[model samples]
Target: MEQIIANGLYLGAQYALIALGLTLIFSLMNVLNFAHGQMYVFGGFVTYTVVVQLGLPFVVGLFASALALAVMGAAIEKFLFAPVVRRSKRDESTMLLAAGVAFFLDAVILLFFGEKQRGVPKVVNGVFNWDMRIIMPYDRILIGVLAVLLIVAFIVFMNYSRSGRAMRALAQDRTAAQLMGVDVSRYSMLGFALGAMLAGLVGGLLVTITGVNLGMGGPTSIKAFLMIMIGGAGVISGAIAGGFILGMMESVGLTVLSAYGDITYLAIFASLMVFLAVRPQGLMGKPWG
Candidate 1:
């Protein structure tokens, strides 16, 4: 039971990290990036390629993965999506554009990395036990700590920094922000890049505990999509809250109802159904005035 709780908390934190990036993208840009999970996988690949393949320091790969994705995100926004947004008559086209990119990227991943799962070398190893009852591994502890610190840092950035303020302003009211001299194109690109960087960092980090493979992007993207839906599409707080909630649900469901292992999805689906029926706006989505 104790281990279950610990695992659930860690999973919740990790999910929240991914959800945070996803929600930020939606909040900053009206486009829903269906290709985010690939970026996540790419991040791990970058780490694996660097640290494992090239024999560099793990930390270098850790940050390099983020930088690589950040650049890719900016390029995607600038060249791919922005061009479509400029000429298109509707925002709906963005979805198709994103979907197209996702499929293309997925194919690219398969071609380059193949279907094999690659394990990340542990950043740190060993386990810790508390009074012979509660036990925690160092790797899990590292993940949880890093996730929390990163999340806190992100929140601080969004709240206190100048660029962060600009993001918040845009998320709140794009027209007003633009009218006040905010550069829409620059910040929009930055928002997308930052979101991708977050996902990539998680990619590198997750590999410390789990193996990375090509198909990871799809399930991860699904969970993120579900997370934001539960939290409300454009609400950052909603994403965080929803992530933790789903994490606990998955943990408890798997632990207690192992026989009905599908309980995680079943519970999520049931909640989604109820939310759609009663309050489709999401837990933290603001009701329009």
Candidate 2:
């Protein structure tokens, strides 16, 4: 039971990281970025290339991946999303644009990497043992610690930084924020870049635990989308709450019923549907007035 709980927390941390990025983008842009999974895959590949291939340090690999994704995110905003926002059309166009980009990137990855599952060297090795039976990997512990630190840093950044405040203001009301002298485009790009960077971080951590491949992006994106929906769309706290909830549920389900893993996902979606029906705004999300 203790092991299950610990495992759940570890998985939940990753979910929260991914969902937080999704929520940030959705809150600011009112569009779901379908290409987010590609960012994760790309981040992992970049980290693998830098650390394993180039023999760079793990930290250097992470930084390189983050920087690469940040640039990609900024460029995407400038070229794709910016044009869509400028046009007078339904937000569906933005969704389509995002999907197109995701598809294109996925294809490119398949072309380049074929269909190989690649893994990264663990940043931390060995295990932690407690008392007589409880044991867990130090790497998982590291993931939890890093997740908490990143969450705290994100909160501080949003609350204390001027740019973060601007982002919040824009999320609340883009037109009002623009009138108040916020450079909407620049902030939009910033939000996207930040989200992408977070995704890259997730990718790096994930590669340590699981192998990465081209097809991994689609499932990851789906999981992220489910997390954002379950947590309540456009709510940061909701994302975090939703991630833990899903992670715990999954862990418990897996522990109790190993053969029925697929059923666990169904249960999760059912819960999400129920939540949407009852709260609509999400568990931690505020209802728009």
Candidate 3:
């Protein structure tokens, strides 16, 4: 039972990290970046290279991956995405643009890596046993701890930091924030860069916990999409709630229906559909003002 709980927490933490950035970006920019998951895959691959090929420590690999993706994200926002935003006739254009980016990045990764799973060395080896039973990997526990810390840090930064307040202001009213002389473009760039950093950090952690594969992007993206939808379309709290909810559901589903793990999503979505029918605005999300 303890092991099951631990597994659920671990999975929830992973989902939280995956969905957090998307939550922030969508809330702040109203841009649903479809390539978010691909950015994560890119981070995993970069982390693997930094650790395995460059003989760097895992910490260095993580930092390098985050930094690299932050720059890439900012560049994409500035060069590729901003232009489209300026000229787009409908909001869906950004979604399609993001899809194009996702496909392009996936193709590039496939061309180079050839669809092979890349293994990452454990940040920590061995398992810690509590009392007689309840065994779990130290690395996984460490990763979970970091994920929680990051989540908290993000919340704090958003609430207390100057830049954080600016972001919130922008999310609440873009035109008003712009009128107030907030650096609109800079914050958008900052938002993308920071969101990409979180995604990259999660990716590196994933590499440490599981392994990297080309196909990871699609599933991660789907999970992220459902998380936002379940939580609330643009609510960070909703994303967090939805992630843990989905994680626990998957954990229990795997335990009970071991052979039909995928059924968990069906159950989750069914529940979500029912909830949306009743509340339409999501768990933490407010109806539009």
All candidates' TM-scores? 0.96, 0.95, 0.95
- lDDT of candidate 1 over 1-289, digit per residue (tens): 7877887888889999899998998888788879988889988888888888889988898899899999989999899988998899998899999889889878987887788898777778888898766688898899888988999999999999999999999999999999999999899999999999999999988887896899999888998988888788778788888788788878888877778755768877887888867877788887630
Give candidate 2's TM-score.
Answer: 0.95
Tell me how far the alpha carbon of residue 135 in candidate 3 is from the true structure, in angstroms, after superposition: 1.8
For candidate 2, write residues 1-289 as lDDT tens digits.
Answer: 8888888888898889888888898898887999989889988888888888899998898899889889988899999898887894787789889999899889877886667898887789899999736688888898788877888788889889999999999989999999999999999999999999989888877777785899889889999888777778778888898888788888988877667656877777887788789877777777851
Query: Model 2: residues >4 Å from true position, as ranges?
Result: 259-261
Candidate 1 matches the true fold with a TM-score of: 0.96
Please list the Cα RMSD from the true structure of every candidate, rounded to 1 decimal place.
Answer: 1.5, 1.6, 1.6
Q: How do these models rank on TM-score, best leading? A: 1, 2, 3
Instruction: State the C-alpha lDDT per candidate.
Output: 0.87, 0.85, 0.86
The candidate, 1 or 2, that scores higher on lDDT is 1
Cα error of candidate 3 at position 120, Å: 1.1
- Output the TM-score of candidate 3: 0.95
